[model samples]
Target: MDALMAAFVAAALAQVGDRPAWLAAILADRYRAPGLVIAMAALALLGAGLLAAAAGAVLAPRLTPEAKQLFLALALLFHGGGALFPVKAPERLDRWRIGAAATSLAGLFILAFGDGVQFVVLALAARADLPWLAAAGATLGSLAVIVPAAVLGERGWTALPLVPMRRIIGALFVVAALWLGLDALRLI
Candidate 1:
């Protein structure tokens, strides 16, 4: 329980004004239906976190220390490598065919895949042996910030000052990725 709470607090603090905000800003810029977009994004994040948590819970008891270290090292390597080369910007949401819901889901999947927050939350959840609680906490923490940002983003680009925020968040993500990578490698 203490571990869960600590992981939750750490994950929550790490998420604020970073990846979630950036995701919200991107969705707002690309999509028309903010509410639907937010919902879809929330669902996608929830799904990913749940999946990660399940994996963590199932594997926790079996993993040797060396195996655990190796897994963490690999995760850090992949995440850090990804931070170095971001994906191309997603196409603007098509408002008619797929509508806002699908677009939101797609956007969420894309963003969550690249998000340091998601990785950190999953790693902590896995390490702490409380996948479900960690997943729930991470999902909630992500949405708590993202939904508001989407709402504000819908108002206008100026409503959130998204451009500068994006840059700041991007930089933070790189730093986090590097730190996590180094920590995993026992090089920090």
Candidate 2:
């Protein structure tokens, strides 16, 4: 479905060089448990996606299609603008008494909460009235990026041209937002 693919591609693009990916790389390097880090990261992303999708679904029936489009446009604009800013460094969780796996899960989940990707997932789900599909797509898309970060560790991850990738993706989101906004306003 359009919603699913849109969520997937958008989340994947938005995730590059983001804090969550950095956290994944840091955890993989620190714990020397890339598998555990990847698994925890997937779980965290899935949880966040489901929560966002659910919120979007709850609003689906309340709005007209044009209103949903407007809302989604706004969300995309926010995501695009935020992507232009450099992400803050991921925090080290050295003091947690929990094992590496639990720490990873908690840290990743905390970092993902209310992030730009989640906002896009929420908007897409509402627009398409396909919350579960959007959530699944977002989870899978996020994993596609996070897995490499976990496998690569910090040094390898740092070598990526994440800044340029992020800028391009941000520009794409802005273009999509503008188009959608125009359509929603019946000016296109």
Candidate 3:
């Protein structure tokens, strides 16, 4: 239980601190509807977290240590490669008209889909023992990171230095992925 809780906390913090906040801020600014955008983003994250928890509950026990290690390693490699060689940023939201709500939602969904932090949280939650607690913690932690970013974004982009923060979080993810991989391999 202790180990599971620790893993949950560690994973939650890592996910919360990662690049999603920066993306959320950018999205909020682009959409010019920080409140709605933030809420939708939070809903997407929450839904993903719930799915992860469900998966964890169903799959964690069946996974062998080797399989877990392999999964972690693959996840790390995939996510790290993505961060190291990021794709071009998406085009700005079309917020010029009032009928852009559907477009905005679609854009938010796409943004959340590309959010590595959301994926990390889901993966970690899927590995956690207390899936409910892990999911709740991750969901709340994500909101903690995102709400602030959205607020700051609404105020102004200059209100925060997101670039350095993103690098820091990315480094943390690399370290975490390596750590999980090592543990899964029984090398830790």
lDDT of each: 0.61, 0.89, 0.59
Ordered list by TM-score, greatest first: 2, 3, 1
| Cα lDDT of model 3 by residue, 1-188, tens digit | 43245434544444443455555676677667778767776676666666666766676778875775566565555555455443344455545354334544555556555555445544555566666665566556666677777777734543555445545655665776788777777898
lDDT per residue (tens digit) for residues 1-188 in model 2:
88889888888888888888989999999999999999998899989999999999998999899999998998899999888887788897878879998999999999888578898888889987568888888888888889999899989998999988888888888999999999999999
Give the TM-score comparing model 1 with the true structure, all chains together.
Answer: 0.62
Which pairs of residues have clashing backbones in candidate 2? none
> Better model by TM-score, 2 or 3?
2
Assess candidate 3 and give its TM-score to the true structure.
Answer: 0.69
Top TM-score prediction, candidate number: 2
Off by over 4 Å in 3: 1-23, 30-32, 85-87, 95-105
Pairwise lDDT winner, candidates 2 and 3 = 2
Q: Candidate 3, residue 33: CA error in Å?
A: 4.0
For candidate 1, the 10 contiguous residues with the lowest summed lDDT are 81-90
Give me the overall lDDT of model 3.
0.59
